[model samples]
Target: MPSVFSALPGAVLDDSGLLHLGSPLVEQRRLAAGEAIAPLGDRAVIAVPGEDRLSWLDSLTSQALTRLDPGVGTELLVLDPQGHVEHAASVVDDGETAWLITDRGDAEGLLAWLRKMRFRLRVDPRAADDEFAVVGGTRSALARVVPATPAGRPLVWIDPWPDVSPGGYGYAAVDPHPGADRDWAEAIVTRDEERRIADAAAAGDLVLAGLTAVDALRVAAWRPRWTTDVDERALPHELDWMRTAVHLDKGCYRGQETVAKVHNLGHPPRRLVALQLDGSDSVLPVHGAAVRVGDESVGTVTSAALHYEEGPIALAIVRRSVAVDAVLTVDTSDGVISAAQEVVVPPDAGRTANIPRMPRLSRRASAQ
Candidate 1:
């Protein structure tokens, strides 16, 4: 179904929904100031309802979910056996069901995996995208626009990024993390409500931001996203995701061993960095654009945007050995552009354990 947001004047939509509305910069300002909301058409919802839902999910993901409280928002990651991220979701339980909000492209795969893993468990996970749409903005902005409460509790997921969640670890060492001021949340609304919100936007009663403005704010906040930042070999450590997603003391899951080993004794092979791109050429590098150190390719740009306050900014995953102070270049369609690196995950991000060293004995002393 075509998004009702496309009905607004100057709105341009892609396969997902509203990409922009002609004035992305202005939209960004309004959105950040709590005067606008963005329709998250690229996000999908999954409803997991059953007697054993929380415990079943607790056994399958990175977060400790067995005791998840009603209306509290958290995130979880499903990993491959090797600890590579396979799926990620924002979770909120309404005392009866756990709602999983994930990327639209990942919804089918995640649902299939959940169904396949339900071995006589009471949980039933089903796609809820047809019934609900996601809307994102500041907490206050959403409060002004009431969200759906089909079960008598507002369906909202508050982001926990840049904070060390209970049983979770943090890798970023910067004081006052860039995401500290990000007051973001997502609300699940009925399809009828989505149309009504769009109508209000069309009538100038409500302000609407687009995905472009949303991405800009996200990049500025140093937020990692599932669709844009994750790759086949991506790990929570590499993306500084330990701050919110991985529970260091959680019970065993598919990738728990690797997650523990990396944090305690080994370093992740890659590290995430924020890039302040040179905007002289006015071209933003696309995803997979090579990040270079001198002439050597060191990484690939994951997400890039023209932020309202920061100009051109991007997030990239680079080899762990890359110098934090390295002046890098990014290959764009227009040309190669210079970028300065701001470390998100340091090269020494792992090996958090304090193992004691054993004394070595000399051969002569051992003979005695």
Candidate 2:
């Protein structure tokens, strides 16, 4: 389906239909101020409807969803047997249905996995991208334009980042986390509502931002995204994702052992960091660019953007062995740009268990 946002003036869309309406920096400021909304063409929705929806999802993912109350927003992760993140979604239940919002590129695979997991369960998971579109902005901005009870209740997924959710643990020990001020939410709207939003923007009644602006704000928030942050070896602990996505006390699910083992006995092999890049060259390093410590490669940049307040910032997944104070550089197409690291996940991020250590024996006792 064609995006209704494509009709708005100054709308420049990428192949995936994400809009960059001429001025992304300006859009970022406006969106952050709760004066604009961004059309999220890169997002997709899945609908799970059945009596067993909540319990079924709880048993399958890394969250305690069995008692997920209506209209309460949370997120979940599908981990591989090794506790590597395979899929993730922002979740919200509207009593009768559970809406799973994820990156558009991963929606089909996630939906298929959900369907395959349903063995005689009353749950039916199906793609709902054709029926709904996502609009992202502050909660108040979204409320003004989106119908609150379009589907009997608000279908907004409020981000719960930088917060240690119930049964979750905080690894980023930083004071005043970067995402503290991020008031972002994504609202699921019907096609007709999408058109209405487009019309309002076209008529100068509503201000619209673009994916570029949205991403800038997200990167500044130290928010780890599925497409940019996850790799074959990516673990929830490595990205500080356990703070929001994983319930440490949740019942057994796929990868629960690994999650417990890492949190209780071992530290994550890698850690996520926020990099303050040198803006003198005005070039943001692209994703997957190698991060270097002096002469050796230490990590790869995951997400990078030029922010409205902060000049240029990026998120990188570096080896946990890398010194926290080490000066890092990114190998971009332009040149090796220097980056000052802000720890998102510290090197000592795991081993959260309070196991008591055995008292040491004295040398005299050993002789005896």
Best by TM-score: 1
The residue-by-residue lDDT of candidate 2 on 1-368, one tens digit each, is 66777767788998667558888899999999999998899999999999999999999999999999888889999999999999999999999999999998888889999999999999999998778888999998987676435458989888888788999987876566767788998998888898888888899898999999999899888888898899999999999899899999979999999999999899999999888887463688988999999989999999988878777788999999999789899988788988878777877778752322322211112212
Error of 2 at 144 (Å): 2.0
lDDT of each: 0.88, 0.86
Residue 185 in candidate 1, Cα distance off native in Å: 0.6
For residue 4, give model 1's deviation from the true position in Å. 0.8
The local distance difference test score of model 2 is: 0.86
What root-mean-square deviation over C-alphas does model 1 reach? 9.2
Model 1 misplaced stretches (Cα beyond 4 Å) = 352-368
The weakest ten consecutive residues by lDDT in model 1 span: 359-368
Clash count for each candidate, listed in order shown: 0, 0
- TM-score, one value per model: 0.95, 0.94
The Cα error of candidate 1 at residue 327, in Å, is 1.7
Candidate 2, position 296, lDDT? 97
